[model samples]
Target chain A: MEKSKTNPNKDFYGKTLMGIEIFVRSLIEENVDVVFGCPGNAVLGIFDALLEISGIKIILARHEFGAVLSASGYARATGKPGVVVASSGPGASNLVTGIADANMDSVPLVIFTAQVPTKLIGNETFQEVDIVGITRPITKHNFLVTKIEELTSTIKSAFHIATTGRPGPVLVDLPRDILAEKFTFDYPEKVNLRGYNPIYSAHSGQIKRAAEIINNSLRPVIIAGGGVTISNAFGELRELARKINSPVATTLMGQGVYPEDDQLSLGMIGMHGTWYANNAVNESDCVIAIGSRLDERVTGDFNKFAPKAKKIHIDIDPSSISKNIKADVPIVGDVKDALKKLIPLVKNLNNEEWLSQIKKWKNEHPLKYKSTDKVSVPFVIEKLRDLTGANAVIVTDVGQFQMWTAQFFKFLYPRTHITSGGLGTMGFSLPASIGVAITVKDRPVISINGNRGFQINLQELATVTAYNLPIKILIFNDGHIDITRQWQELQWRKKFDEILIDSSCPDFIKIADAYGIQSFRVEMANEVEPTLKKALALKDKPVLIEFKTIYEENIFPYIPLGGSVSDIIEH
Target chain B: MRHTISILVENKFGVLTRIAGLFSAKGYNIESISVGPTEDPSISRMTIVTNGDDDQIEQIIKHLNKLIDILKVVDLTNEPFVERELALIKVKVNPYTRGDVIEISDIFRAKVVDIGPTTLTVEVTGKSDKITAMINMLAPYGIVELARTGVVALKREFKGEVYTSKEIKLIKKKSRQKQVEDDEKG
Candidate 1:
């Protein structure tokens, strides 16, 4: 208990500590058990400190990208903020995409990148890059510690900003010279931040007004997003929807916010949303957007998105409220708090006719893929979901496999679905799944990725073997980027730069084997289920199942860009 | 719609870039912006003047508040506020136009701080409109150079609230009415 404002460098009890040691102590205080990162010469002082500490453990990945992505997955699996400590220049630069992924997904992560000496900052020294400047836009907030005295308080602030109100990644860059310098460790007793207040509860008047509008509507629908998962508002979302007898549709990030198997569930909504979900949104009389930004991807066309409906948007960020669509009643608060206030005020009315209409649409436009001799990605996902009993954490890299999993997998619990939704960073799943497996030990952690994207962080397989994280990885090996190839074929593939077909055909099984991971390849449809069951059952070793799916299989019920929900293309 | 927004932020390096980056990233244009340290050396104030419709301006204000270093944000567009800007205009002053240039500077209440052999520099502090008017008058004299400190603004003391977002105008009006009714009752 020390006052940092009066004398920041004051010794707590007439003793000084190295900056890196102080950081390690602060991590222990923050209840962080492990940090994911790759160490370098710039951060050698930190590694020395870690060598002496027994309170914390560190996971060293092959690359900075893997390390950062692992931290992101760790944050998503647990509500607490994840931590990453990387070296300067290339190490920090390699983390850009993963850090952006965390920012876009609102995953809480506190990243530390060791910098060169203060004098060498502008002199173009070895391994010197303006990482703080490069990551400014992507990070929620960042701080560069030029003075040793400010290190402790800045780390505290970084954690606070990363974990609270619309959670996102924050970075703290410390020069090696500062870390090596001796400074008094004054851990402030209280956090004093003037500009970082987050509204946690809804204004009573706005909540009441929204409730009244929702109660009076004949057709009501709720669109939940990742914020629900971050807020732990799944129970509240369920309660509000059930009370109002409303159907629930979700954005890609909103996968597990509501149980997909429930009668009131309309699977994921928007671009690759279920036909019934998209139909319900288009035809609803009222649209209640909770914990979601109502992003352009989720709203196929802004003008036509829930156009006729009376809108109620509940989110932590005010800017997210009317950025894309002007909400009729914009409630700037945490969705859980807003929904808790809303459920009590709304009247319980069963819209039997509306529910029946949605049911009819579901029957007519069910998620269907042409079953052939070649096993499909959708089929594998369905098998994977069934084998895991809808309890495993599903992490997806970006592409058609991502959409397929969203379409077929039925998630029953919150924090059980993890993916690179907003930034859609390729090769995110392997490292992220390792983080997920570490955090959630009892349940299975599965990383489903496309062939080309999986190689983005294939080096992480060594980290996986090193740590012995018992996670399952699947690469739908259809060669080149399937989603891009699909779009090309649909619209002038002949005229464009040579179609990327059968490119980047790496032997994933061989690659996984080289890293000493148990890998299996399934060429036939019958081998998929048995292989998945066996892979998911392994408790000590990580497993990689290469499902040789056809590259031409495209995700359907896709709303073309600039097209409304009604303009879904079935081909 | 044009808006004058005043923001107080923690005095730190790179805060200006964060603010400027937000405007450009969102595709919003900042017509003119001015920033400097406030009375408290640890904090700085920024005055931003931008043109956009109501929705666009609303987003800008909300995004500004979202930045971690920003302490306070107030839109002085709808309030009674005093605005001032400093401009230095270097004008060509030949013998014929020298008297005319001095007369124009005196008419605008500007000071001819420096008088060179061929150029007269006028230092003026006034509302943006007044400065613009003087610049127009001196333009015919072949102005050599011009520099302006974008308008700095502060609301009149009678306007109470120091912090604002979206539409606190309704709250202010309601509170004023309540006060009036209480005064009558008393």
Candidate 2:
């Protein structure tokens, strides 16, 4: 066996590969199988290398946001950092909302953007935007590739950081000059990012302290946050909860972190959260907030949120400790790692009395909705969930319907429930659903959206049909932003401005028909399940089911910020 | 509840804009913000006052620190810090009250350097409370102009090092690598 003329010098060997090739090869090595992007002059080199690759398919999206959304959907589905590539300036700027959504949701994603040549960067060359700076707050970390030598390490670091503790989006901004430059590619053995030191394992002492706090409490409630899902610690969380016999209440983003059918599960808590879940949080002696920041939506009134409880916050982000609703015991590490450290230290005491008390609270304050003469959104969501067998992915746009879907649907698996919880970006559901459907071709994915949210991104309907995806869009067509409209009706006495759409939106049924997809509208309450079943029954192309809804509907169990979730104002 | 926080961050591109975007997206009202590079070459300090609860304020700080450019967040409200707010108040003073105003400025330890025929410009540097007190006393004299540098603070025992996020990161990285090396050699 002859090893032909290997370069004796390490530096000489490494100096042979181009930076773009190094970055591309690094991504492939990280098990990245696909990239969503559109190429331009700045990123022509990368596109050339990406073209030669046979396994990693590159999906050319019409818009940068669409590509990023598809990447986000991919991240949610696979629990790996999804990748999106875009050219400089407008292309990068368009990815802002998608990146912001990932930041807010803590979804793992990698966005690669081309910049103007290094020489023209400060000179404001054409199509040059400070993408790294643009994406700072919306990213876990970011890099500006200044040299060809840094490209390989930068890509590796970005992947490591993005998929690690408290996963979020990361951007690698490449200047055109660097991409055009030639350098040898040697994949870095390890990343050496200066400021990023993520602790994946919990400190044993802190974990023990947390366990002691949990053991000593009477009414202990596990306030599961998005962290559980991010860490893939559902099994551990379930075991710990079962060991302690404590009920688990989730934040909106915390859906699917625990099995919905678990006996100890109390469902989502906060504004528009279930009564039992909120009551459990309020009445608990100890509030073990795992991976949640206790955002205003979750806390309701901050001062009063779980006021009586001794808070124990376990999060990877240090700032989250005592940042919101001060924690008595704060454990800074990954939720899974924290649980692993703490579980053994905790005494397996059965809090049967506390559990029974919570059960009573659940029985007394079952989520009550007024039986209006009109068809209800919850009824539609419930039927849809049943027809799809809870196996279908549920995507919701933010509003009354978003909350209602949370209330109605029970998610058993992680990533099954995808919603814009952080950014709460409207029109996100349909595009994201299309992404999910594309990724999971066999699963029946459905986007349950409000009429207004559906209108915001209805243009994606063309993309849906163009791709021949099997996703179904169920729109709660109330004709306006019902959540904001309800507040307007209540606070301003019918001075409605923001919620009302001036121009009538195109008929979704007609629009779907034009797109060559099956469409239906259900007005009567009895017609909802049948309509949903019909839509689900069709597996060839996407379907749209529009339910005629009342214009001004409000989500109930409403705790205005800084108030206890238990003290809800029903609409 | 309202909180005024000072954040020292690296003067990287899009950082301030990103911070502004975050505040807007989160629906937090940013009452005032002043940002510029400090004594350090690379770092910039941003003074932002937001209205919300203590918890909300802390959350804002945490989220702000999450930005790659942000070095550290100092809730100057709790710490022993020197806060200065510069205000250029152009008061429409008649000759009769001009002397009295100057005397008052002397009493308050303020400087009245720019003087016009009908108006006098008083530059004051003090804590927000101190500035507000002087402004109230000067208000009765029919003030024609008012411009204020909202608020800026520095820690009293300040080491004049650049407080960029990058520097802090470098320190952390160094320490972590050292630890790994130590573990390997242990």
Candidate 3:
């Protein structure tokens, strides 16, 4: 509706609205359903504007870090760009880790941060930080809106840049003065960035060449990554794998992109990957790496990673194609598009002997763990996965619990398993689980975290209780950073250093109780399942179940640093 | 393993920072970088010289192309391109070496832009190698100060599509109108 009385250009303008209102309206135009925010003095006007908006919901996080992590989780789970807002200075600085994580993982997010008034910006005013400068490297793109005229357009550009191409976090630093200023509310329908054009389809010639390579190779293994999930190429990945009679191995980030329970699945392939997965990748004649950057954790030693294989890397980001491992056939396009084109050109292969060899390797060195007298983290993860089944969304924090969850959980679907794979951010689980729970309200959302990791953002418990989110928080309390200690023990001649956490770690059950969340602690093996079940049964409120796991327990099937895939320590 | 890359980008705020940040974050050492406005006021071109192996340079080009403000990235190191650097050198010129300095500047086709009692400022614009050679020849006269504008490069012949300012503006406007119409229909 045009407000001709107040508007100079009736055809191009609408009713005059506050800059804050325009910002919120632009987000709504982008189809953002929820915004995770922690309000401060600079963002009060925006908060006031948000209260009047009926269609969008704002989830108030206790900390700015919690807000961004939750938004990242929501983005990964829903396949939509997550939105977050925070006040100036410390609030914006607090978002650095989450922003970096989102960028590293290629999760789409649009972050709005409050800035000090434009006049007070460079005078060293209170609550003023060069947020744009700080986040320049981490964010895909960012804006510092100094003028009211640039507010809506900047917000629109931020959203477009965040969700397109290689999706990553984008920030818009809104000055407090602009938030209070009045402006015409004209949301741009589309952003036309001349520089940002992403290739969605593969070249037919390259696809044909890739198919020929796959069809000719008797020992071919497919290595899928987060790109597969991001592009929704799981179906295509499966079709291609089935056609070529190839076993599929996934990177940690690509865990759920292919069903782990499938006969052709080779679990995960990396440092902590299963023996068979590593062996299959090492022994393969051809390696089809889709949507993966081949990070150091996955590659072990770049010189020897898939050495014998003729590698084919298909990714949306061309920079990721040969950054770590050189690809013979580099298809710079979306994984789904590349796979779709490739499947048609590939003929069904009879690699029964190669498959049998892989099966023998799997039988010889399956994922093994001893069930000790005390409760173990991996055992709990397996039992929890069994109880929750394949429908539950699993989120994890970094460290030992993260690796254990990745190893034990059998994800049958994409977007069902969420973790900070690239950034390896600790304290991501609890808040991220809150986000996943919000996105998929009907499914069970479980967060598996270590004690050291969970306490990084323990304040998020308040947000979970405030929203009455039914997120099941499972804390594996080993009393210290278990993975670091394990590494020190193995590599540094058992000289335990700063890896041990101080005894001053908070009483987690009491901490959860303080936040009005249902809390439980289990130490015995028999009590684990019942505790998990009890936590899962609660429908109206969030629950925290802490298991006192063995402190010295180490994750096995580890490939030593700088070692090849074949040099695995399977203890 | 030196590579020359020419980047065409929108003349937007923070575009330089984004490009520089990408290079540093990815661990590519920039040997030299020069940014200046193109013929169109709305567009800027950046010439970056960096040292990396073939794969690293390719990755750098690809990464540069990924930036939202970058329109085009041309790695001219492998192409037939002409590159030039401008340097202003002030040399301490005594009576004995003043004639020698003037002779050297004359031989190199450099101009003496400024003269002080004991120093002569020589301005030289040539290929990077020539400029370096000139500086070395003037070093015998005891150089006092030096400032150099990093390399600016261009291909001898146009090989890619070049967008005029009007065409770019028109394309931007048309795309926006189409998007607005689509939104209204939806």
Best by lDDT: 1
What docking grade applies to model 2?
incorrect
Candidate 2, residue B151: how far the Cα is off, in Å = 17
Q: How well is each residue in A199-295 modelled by candidate 2, as lDDT tens digits?
A: 7778888777788888898889999988888888898899889888888988888898988788899989887788888888888889999989888
**Model 3 segments beyond 4 Å from truth?**
A1-13, A497-499, B158-186
| Candidate with maximal TM-score | 1
- Model 3 whole-model lDDT (C-alpha atoms): 0.87
What is each candidate's DockQ, to 2 decimals? 0.72, 0.21, 0.62
| A1-571 per-residue lDDT for model 1 (tens digits) | 3334543233442368877878877776566788999989888778678768635678999999999999999999897898999999999999999999999889999999999999889788899899999999999999999998888788888989999999999999999888888887657666779999999989999999998999899999999999899899988999998999999999998889899999999989988888888888888889999989999889888998887799999999998999999999999998889988989999998999999999999888898998877789999988888887898899899999899888899888888888999998989999999888878987888898888788788989988899898888888988767888777776665455355665557888888879888889998898888888788778778898898888667889888778897679884
CA-lDDT, candidates in order: 0.88, 0.80, 0.87
Write the number of the candidate with greater DockQ, choosing between 1 and 2: 1
Can you tell me which runs of candidate 2 are displaced by over 4 Å? Answer: A1-19, A39-45, A372-374, A497-503, B1-186
- Candidate 3 per-residue lDDT over residues A250-295, each given as its tens digit: 9998989888999899988899998889888898999999999989
- With a 3 Å backbone cut-off (N, CA, C), the pairs that clash in candidate 3 are none
List chain B TM-scores, each candidate: 0.84, 0.78, 0.83
Candidate 1 Cα deviation (angstroms), residue A456:
0.8
lDDT of 2 by residue, B1-186 (tens): 757789887776667777898898678998778888899968888998778977677778777766656777778766456678888889888889999999989988989879999999989888778888998999999888899888887766747464446668989899999999999999
What i-RMS does each candidate reach, in Å? 0.6, 3.2, 0.8
